[model samples]
Target chain A: MAPLRDPALEEISEALHAAPGAETITRLSAIDAVRARILLAIEHRLYAPGEQLPPLEALAEGLDVAPITARRALETLVEDGALVRRRGRGGGTFVAASPPQIQDSAVNVFRADEDAIRLLIDQRCLMESALVAAAAERITVEECDDLEALVDAAEQATTWAAFHSADRRFHRRCAELSGLVEATSYQTTYEMLARYFLPYPLDRLGGSHREHRAIVEALRAGDGSRAATTTREHVGSLRRDMFMALPR
Target chain B: MAPLRDPALEEISEALHAAPGAETITRLSAIDAVRARILLAIEHRLYAPGEQLPPLEALAEGLDVAPITARRALETLVEDGALVRRRGRGGGTFVAASPPQIQDSAVNVFRADEDAIRLLIDQRCLMESALVAAAAERITVEECDDLEALVDAAEQATTWAAFHSADRRFHRRCAELSGLVEATSYQTTYEMLARYFLPYPLDRLGGSHREHRAIVEALRAGDGSRAATTTREHVGSLRRDMFMALPR
Candidate 1:
């Protein structure tokens, strides 16, 4: 494949990392970029999960930032639970074995670009559909039963954050069943971008909860296509119901 | 979502990045890790496409490697066309707008782990099917004709690398039609692992070329399911036909 990045996405990437982008897009600090760089290293596996990083001085120098800048960036990421540091010998700084999903402090990029947002949704629809179908084919009756608990957990969640967290568990469990390592991992990493785009709401919860249950039932019946269809419809609805899709 | 990583995947990430995992895994020096970290920054959007990076001294210290080691790593990546360097004022180090696919000097990691290979293949299948369907929904009659050219480009390729390159152009074009930025980006990055797993050969060229042509036809007819089914079958065949599947 040519690996040609879409022109719009190329701009989004710039907006994400630079201060010189289109007006209205929030500007990021050098420190933010540094933290993002280190986090990217972990997400991309350049810095293995749980591997100790270089000394602060070395890290700061190599990154070409003031030592204070590197130190602060690292500290923020640590606060986000993306990294963990320990004192004494045999410890400097380490990528979290299982890093928490980062909440982007900047969501303006998504808010400002409707066309890019549409593509984002489409891309997600493609991935989520395939993952659900792949998972359906591999999900067993017992696993289907486990997925039900996850579904109910979302429906019963009292808050938007709670529901979103539970909702992801349901999907994550399905992806686990598929055993597609990189596909699943790709989805996981993509969420760092995906999650920040929409502030959660219980506004569409009832309908979404129904779809979740429907997907599980389809999986239980070994109907991969049916599960995939519901998944597509669910994500496709984002075009009508997502933040940008509403009055905004 | 939960973003819970599977234990097997966790191991693969570590294997891909570190030298201390499976005995059969090739060792990566500090310099290799340095190159990877910098590359990850680009892929993760922390560095951004075409963004300028820090001076060599700062870069060397930030990553905690010797200056010479940093220099060599930077040079190799630049030679690979992943980065571009210019001398004098207003020039330092910049990530290439469109970087080339990296060839991992190491494939032993994939060879040694049969299970991970299966998952990687499954992940690709998931992505390809969805991307095909997504493209089908959006593909124009004119675009279908362009896809035909890509199919032929792959078929007429005289070498494995040429065919792979042409073949990727076809897929990348399809993803562009969908506009899913992170999903496409995730796939591009995942290939760093996926591409290295199997050394290219003319072994399965004929069938692959046929599938490529058929997928384009399915798009021409706007038959998303047909396109998706064919994709799944073609990728499924890899589980049976890949090198790991071959009797040693």
Candidate 2:
């Protein structure tokens, strides 16, 4: 197949090559780029479980890559247990019935380096602080109420599992209320980084709930500075708590 | 060759596949992962320009991937203009004599979406704020002097080009002074994002220099909060300035 004639892609390519004195370019091969897009789509649930992917030829045509390239990409996914291929009538590639679990080892790699963990925390602090500030400025009373309700649900949670679920929802809702589409991606990435620090101590739940309450109050009052400060402190506390709990 | 059996590769693969309840696991082909690692190393200058890479067989052995996979990874790099392969004796893979410029298209892809640009700025604000705060608390007198020197250089700069170079140095030095190794990577990523909005109008150079002076003063005084505020404002101003300059 001829390379896809995508104007956006072409524009990107031109900008990279033509930028004067450009030293180095960060790039992905055609196959890798296609794979990344498909993976992202699947992660976002654009393709439901057990969904059949288009035939190799059609998939290759859509992405504007050779069929061999597309097949290689699919093969890689198959190796990762993300897809299964079958032959015969009505047989083709399908999302795996049960995709392999992200090995603990993978998460371990992210959490492996002490410095990386701290950096991740620093990054989260920065993104969330800005997000809270924006949310405070734009959140309506109804959205404030929604956040308060999530906080209440967390406070009343009888199990760690239930409380954790509420905690995730509250933070996510806060991002949504910020009215920035980009915050959603930040929130998603933040959640992934946080997975390594999950099952926060039950004893600290009360304090955490209070912190959430403070954030909601700040948002309700349209106090951007206060919202940012509270968010920073809350996230900072997580980092502190995690570091302190690590074995010496 | 049988899949190169390296403990490190096995660890990574197991970690990827073994995470419990991993509904979706994002992965790279062995070739892609190896390529990414080598590329990152090159970008970081682990392999300087003009440096010759080890033979393909050795690289394959080191990464514990099949020799063919390792060869494919190198081939991809060659295709990207990151490396050159020569034929006959004394020829292996060497860093390209003159690497292809990172295409303007790649940078444009980053700057194409207005919201993505904004999100990038917000992320930078957060990280830099935290970084400056830390730097304020811990920066030594010698480090403070070093920063002041950079600021002075910017102020004395007769040309916009000179000022821009000093400006980049000043910001990078700030991250380094923070005593956080991770901050350096954040600073690098932030600079790449900022490149698209560069070539500050000559009129704004003086104002930008003053902001740098204020940040230096805050660092000198060991005022973490003030340093954070000043740094945040400085970065925020860049975002504001760029947005205002964009065509309506």
Candidate 3:
């Protein structure tokens, strides 16, 4: 994929500036800005896996950023296992394929489930619980409607893949509604893992749909505890469904 | 940190190639070879945080690999979050400043009770238990000696910081002994967090020392279960000590 700029990041940065006085604005350092730009580029597949990046000077010119700033951005990517580099006569930078292996010994099981699918569901639950707790105090009317629509879409999904995709989107939108960007970003790894192990089961879709509905109903009724409770149950069901789909 | 290749990686790759027979020689793919080279360089702090990497073409020439191949290596670095890229006048790649946040939750209260510290200790127990179980069937004599020395160093430490440092080394060495590099990497993160948050109570250091002796003795006896148990109890004492030191 071609490398492209992410206007959304700039838009978000602008919104942050406008929402607060200039004194309160937290401008990203050049390195962070460059790093975020590259991540966005990867997410959008503007720079697809296995593609070579332009020369450092060319990249700096294209991004309208300083060479050092771009350099840090690339370094951050490498640390995250998103890119690799080498030096010599015929070498240049290129995009990396796949993701890095995150070691998960029992000591640091992050969220404490063994199976990848189970961890994915638990992770979503933890984030949703945090978000719904906050959203109950501040969810906007428009957001409430949007959440309900997502639940409806999931409920109407005919196949497992469609239902699963909708399910993630529904939960993700909930996190968005809560207005916590970092929490949303934290789930990116889980999302990537989920994609890697796609074509999960549909037999348990009905159970998930019901749970999703309960969560929506609770949100509509402005009950934080109920929303959390429903979300927990829903996540539990997803965990079971995921395990069932896997061959022992 | 100078920007250079990782000597250890180079040595290992060379050793693998020098193993003589094709059967003994394991050739890494070009991408992996370059990636390993970069990691070795970075891990040894060849590229310090914020240090600019060599130009892509320059790197390619030095490595005697095609420019595209070199670019792929750089891309792998980017993917790993080690480096960032820029496009403009005087732009280049550079190392990342801070490590990525490992999606750790505040599950181990580490504060609520002696239970809090003990719970985290229990996690270490579980991890080490798994490691020992694996290691009993896999450890080499040299690794056992490393573990023994690490334990001795911890026992000899006087200050809280020194003891904690040695304690981390001991536990990490134990994992390394298990021949599970990936799991041991996770153990490194666990050790970092534990060391960061768990303060040592100097007065109780003697008890911890005895526990370490017990663990080593168990390992010497080739009793995996006993070694695992001893390690858990040893970590448990540290937890209890932390509890007593907590602000009343």
Candidate 4:
């Protein structure tokens, strides 16, 4: 019911209003949107564990919403156990010391049948290919070196945990290099969905590393299309591996 | 924080508690999530314009949330001008008569640069290809005939508006035929974003129709891969057209 307060928010609202047959989103919707963004930030580790978020007023101004709206958003996070609000002169809102863990059953979040799983895999293939293509065009030499290092780390990983960590960083770095912040943000969602299919067999590590190496090499060569193609194949291979690993 | 009341709600809560590094989504969060799903249903025309929604109690039972949570969710929509809440024995929440229009600026929802747009297009390419592949494998003769009718309608369309509607139905039908409900649901989000790039020139219609015919042929022949490839090309062409139409 609140009037448009921020110009950016107003622009977004106006766009939604103009969309034919689209339902209107109100200022209250902004509260949810802001909350989701902050939660995503925390989930992605953009806000490190135990890190304090900006004061409510500052967050409100930054998001161009009323202080009450920002406060409500933060309160939702607090209620959700994603954040801890401290009182006293030095106290503020902080990322929870312990955030909720995504259970193995988190795949249930997809509420998807096997067909939907395949569809999700298909989506990932396309999205990752695009990320690699964009990264190939814009990735700096330094970023390329970072990717190489991640691949090398994965190759040497004696434990599946270490290998998986490096593998996630490798893919996430590619998204970051693509210079699409939203895409990078979305990579977290993809990874969360992927957690269910993980703990890939140690035997598959060698093959996976090889695929990662090919992706990095293609990026190093600045061949966008090649990078994209290789990335697609790489994701396809993972999908195959997942299907094989699932219990019959 | 209200305690979980229903056994089902408690089970979900316990699952969240078991998850590591995930935020706990509380009942209030459910309100927002339910609100979003309902809004999406309305936007996708699952809930037709002017149709009264099921009572809050029914909705709550369906979503397995508290009645209050469902009420709050509907109230949020009411505040947002997406729904009308009326009192009296026969009155209920109805979709607003004039739903908010998404302004041309609604593309701002992506908060994306050009790269994000390209990534989105790539995503569509992959998704559509998968849908077509599934459709190719499973499309009944009746469904194929329906698709043919849609193509014919598009071919005969005199205005871009008419053609666009047929085009949308064609794509949606492909997803529906895939028998992946979640994937079909996701198609709405893709379509919402695609709206920003709509209204193909009259000259482009013939070529577009030809592409559609090729897709339908591939489906009729039960050539899944070919259908997939053709669908990908079709989406790619649309992406190209969109890019060309954008102001330099």
lDDT of 1 at A225: 66
lDDT of 1 at B104: 46
TM-scores of the candidates in the order shown: 0.46, 0.45, 0.32, 0.40
Q: Which stretches of candidate 1 lie over 4 Å from their true place?
A: A1-125, A133-153, A158-169, A172-248, B1-17, B20-119, B197-199
Error of 2 at B243 (Å): 8.5
Alpha-carbon shift of residue A82 in model 4 (angstroms): 15
Better of 2 and 3 by lDDT: 2
Q: Name the candidate, 2 or 4, with the larger DockQ value.
A: 2
Q: What is the lDDT of every predicted structure here? A: 0.62, 0.62, 0.52, 0.60
lDDT of 2 by residue, A72-144 (tens): 8789888888888888998999988766643422223323333434545666765676567667767998898
lDDT of 1: 0.62
Candidate 3 docking class:
incorrect
lDDT tens readout by residue for model 1, A85-174: 998988788989898766554333334444444544555565677777767666778888899998888888765556766766676677
How far off is residue B64 in model 2, in Å? 34
On residues A13-62, what C-alpha lDDT tens digit does candidate 4 reach at each position? 22222212223312226566466556544555556689777667656654
**Which regions of candidate 2 are displaced past 4 Å?**
A1-119, A129-152, A159-161, A169-248, B1-115, B134-146, B158-161, B176-182, B194-197, B200-204, B217-226, B243-245
Candidate 3 — which residues are off by over 4 angstroms?
A1-117, A196-203, A244-248, B1-248
Worst lDDT window (10 residues) for model 4 chain B?
Answer: B13-22
